[model samples]
Target: MSDFLLDPDVVFLNHGSFGACPRSVFEEYQSWQLKLERQPVQFLQRELPELLADARRQLAQYLGARSHEVVFVPNPTFAANTIARCLSLGTGDEVLISDQEYGACRFAFQFAAQQKGFQVVEQSIPLPVESDEAIVEAFWQGVTKKTKLIFISHITSTTALTLPVAQICRRAREAGILTMIDGAHAPGQVDVNLGEIGADFYTATCHKWMCAPKGSGIFYAREDRQDLVEPLVVGWGWGKDKTFHRENEFVEHHEWLGTHDPSAYLTVPAAIAWHKQHFTAGVRQRSCDLARLAVDLASQIDGVHRVHADRFFRQMGLIDITSLQADPVELKKHLYDAYKIEVPVIRWQNRTLIRVSTHAYTSREDIQTFTFALQEAFNQRK
Candidate 1:
């Protein structure tokens, strides 16, 4: 409980958002920042490449991927934007995405589609999901002959539903359609093997479930598909006299995204170490159990409904708040203002949900606190 730096007063239930870092990890982050400040030129020019390379090696090992197949960006949005913008989408080319995807990633694709005279198709995958097979089939229904890529979330943002990305990726390969997976919330919460999933393009945030510092994102492009993505920032990675190039075009092209604090990216190994030490299989199961408890609590409420099945969500669960007479915006404000509970009430795909995320630090008492807070919030509306 005292391992993390999360405020003791506030029952932090929004870990699916930017994750809270541990005291150790935060200190490690600050140390990197101090080192960078001490000798900026020496750190950035001479030592930073090897430092980043070591960090990438450890992170790639954890993610079950080759070190060259992945590179760090600021966030998943940056990776998505770079990939979406770089793709040569012509007129009538379609990128199929589910309705349950994160808004920012969807917008990136939509913006790219608009700029390049292409189409971004959103396939509806309604809640109360039956099975993984059903979800895969439902999403596959939207793929057409003009489909160039399949972009979807490994775990959804608003709904907190974990989609079967591997099944979709496999089917996409069979049909010769490229796959881009937005796996912002999948890394630490779920068992992820990029080699097994095998998407042509994948982006995830270490800051989210991995509990690393903010602004740490990982982008993966296959060796063969590296040509599809060009650098959003045409910096030292391209042209002659590149700082670090070991013949990995993907690493060579997209590694340098202008000079920024590399502290967050460097602290990934610390975060992974923390996760490995604390988050045992039993610990993870208990967290998921708490998430299920949230859905159960919502089910007991008069008007509230559980959004999806138990298997559809991991540490985060979404409970439908549509039946509440109050607006989702006011409901969120009231929940925070009146009760000291911090939870995100989101409206997406025409439904409102009070999404609750329970990380390793979350306790049974915190779940009970939110349970009481939710009931009080709804009762006030009446």
Candidate 2:
């Protein structure tokens, strides 16, 4: 709670949308930017590699990944694009994904599939998922002999449910299919071990849950599978035979994506450190507890229900408000305009849901305020 840099006047219940950075981490990001501006040539050309490697080391230690296995990207969308575009899947090859994927990433695969003459099959995982086994079994039904890759979300963006990604990845590997996990919402909200998950490719955003700067994200490709992918952006690192051996095609392809702002990526270490210093396990537990409270309170309203059990969710929850007749867009505007509470009301799979994202910045009072505002909105509708 002490580490968050959110404003006092605003009740930010939308941490999953775009995470707020800690003041200390923001300062560190600014310092990196200032240093780069001080001597652009020295910073970008001379010192950037060392500084980037240092940041990668810290992040890798925190995430239980090898520094070389992970590279900085602007967001998961870019990371997913790199994998989607690079893989040489052709006609008859299928990329299996879930209906719960983020829209942008889904589009990335769709576009790739279209160009590659491959199929992007969206397998639906029904609501009120019974268990990890049930979810995996349901997804497995979509796999065909032609299936080339299994793409899944570690934590679904719209539903806020944590899928059993590790089990699915293991199964995919056994079947000789590649696995790519979109972990846009996982990193800081839950403990992630890329080695244990054993996915061929994984992508996550630091800005969403790690409280890093806007553009910070990490893309992890398994060492063996690294050779199969091509970088989305071709840059100076493409052919440069430097310190880390350009032999590893993955490292050479994705790391240096033209000259742009590397300040956010450099400041990821500060974000990781800030979380350790202030937002401890106890704080995370408190935030999750409050989020559950909000879900429970909101579900008490007639025509509203919790999307899933507490076990399925981490720090965020989805409330199904599909029974309400009011326009979801209008309801969202009314909440923000009249109540000053910022939250997301999404329409997913023909149902309208309100997703509440809780983080260290959230207080019990904030949940109460959201509950009160929701009650008012429901009452007015009635």
Q: Show model 1 residue runs off by greater than 4 Å.
A: none
194, model 1: CA deviation in Å?
Answer: 0.1
Candidate 2 regions off by >4 Å?
A: 240-248
Query: For candidate 2, what's the RMSD?
Result: 1.5
Number of the top-ranking candidate, with TM-score as the measure: 1
Q: Each prediction's TM-score against the native?
A: 0.98, 0.97
Q: How much is the lDDT of residue 191 in candidate 1? A: 85
State the lDDT of candidate 1 residue by residue for 1-382, as single tens digits. 6889888888888998898888899999999999999999999989998899999999989988889989999888988898789988879899999988888888998898888988999998867889999999899899999999899999988888888899999999999999999999999999899999989989999998888999999998887888888888888888888866754877878888778999999999999998999888899999999999988976898988997888788999888878775587787777777766788988776778888999888888888888888888778667
